[model samples]
Target: GVSRIKEFDKGFQEAVKLAFNTVGIQNAKPSNEIANTTPKTVETIKQQEIKQEIPSNTYTSNGVKYQVATTGNNSFLLINQDNNKVVANFYPSSLPNVYHVEVISDKGHYETIGYSKDNSIIIETKTGDKSWVTTTYTK
Candidate 1:
């Protein structure tokens, strides 16, 4: 039964390759190719280091770095310098965080941006009046 199953699998693979070839794509691989493939050595793996750059006019507070760019009055964009992505948005609010801008919002709704005890940045977005979505960014 094991040999029968192996034969079925091989036939199915051949059928798939034929179907791919009919569509002008070659889905063929020699059995030795998989065994001959190169593996990553310790030296190759060590070359992959985390890359990050802090642009000018960045804000650093609580050991977290952010590229702060003001978009409007009392509104600024918070870009995670290490990740190079817009992680939080700051808006005018009576209440504030360590950045001390005011309120934080994602899409015109009130949100909160603060640091946790571990020194990571935390962003809490309010989807509704009593609902919140919290996101934490670790350095």
Candidate 2:
């Protein structure tokens, strides 16, 4: 049961960080990786392959505490528990095809390339180099 919770947490947090790190407007199509894997994962979840409802866990990294929760349908909401405000939301739309993300922060705003094998979120800009940021929230 704990392992199941961890995996779902893994999926949710990575998706959130993927949205958070994306800075700047970018037009992105889901990579072959997402197209190949996400649909099955989402479908499996829909079929109850994995448990969906899990309690939010808190982790402190560099003095920042995060509350990550899985709402539904592979969607997650992250909040700054210390501040009691929303941090970012990561939601998957139309799996097995193109999944796009939008993250807005004081730093910048960008879109998602979905999640990667290494669990890092890559955000791309419309007409520029690709920048990557690794976010750790622990499963």
Candidate 3:
């Protein structure tokens, strides 16, 4: 009976290996090896996540430069490159590639609308006299 049990166990082990091989999962690592490499794998994944979270490129318009960066939570910041200050906060609009921008100024807060396409961003703002002025920034 013991011999029969041993034979059954051997067959089960071979069956498991064959099933793994059929599914193209050969050379399965032992638990010890997997544990040893897990930290490195986690570190690599963390690095990739950090890269994905980083902000995108800088764009320029009218000799003034601007950088668009993510502020998390689906929000963004528009930074003025000349003074390195955050000039505006950008929130995503319902339309694709469009954002509602709030310009920060010493005078007061003003709202604008902007759209981005390819390497350019176009913003339309209302002047004090209620005239619309459009500015384009390019990468």
lDDT of model 1, residue 120: 48
Among all windows of ten consecutive residues in candidate 2, which has the lowest summed lDDT? Answer: 114-123
Question: How do the residues 70-99 of candidate 2 rate in per-residue lDDT, one tens digit apiece?
Answer: 677666666677877655566654443222
TM-score order, best first, reads 3, 2, 1
What's the C-alpha lDDT at position 125 in model 2? 39
Q: What is the lDDT of candidate 1?
A: 0.53
Ranking by lDDT: 3, 2, 1
The digit string of per-residue lDDT tens for model 3 on 2-97 reads 122357778777777776777884686569866666577667665643212223689887788888878875568878888888877877665556
Report the Cα lDDT for residue 56, model 2.
Answer: 54
Candidate number with greatest lDDT: 3
- Per-residue lDDT over 1-139 for candidate 1, one digit per residue giving the tens place of the 0 to 100 score: 1122357778777777776777885678779977776667754555554221212265665576777666754455777678776756555433333332234335444445543235444556556587877565454
Which one wins by TM-score: 2 or 3?
3
lDDT of each: 0.53, 0.54, 0.73
Candidate 3's TM-score reads 0.54
Q: Candidate 2 clashing pairs? A: 23-109, 23-110, 24-109, 24-110
TM-score of 1: 0.29
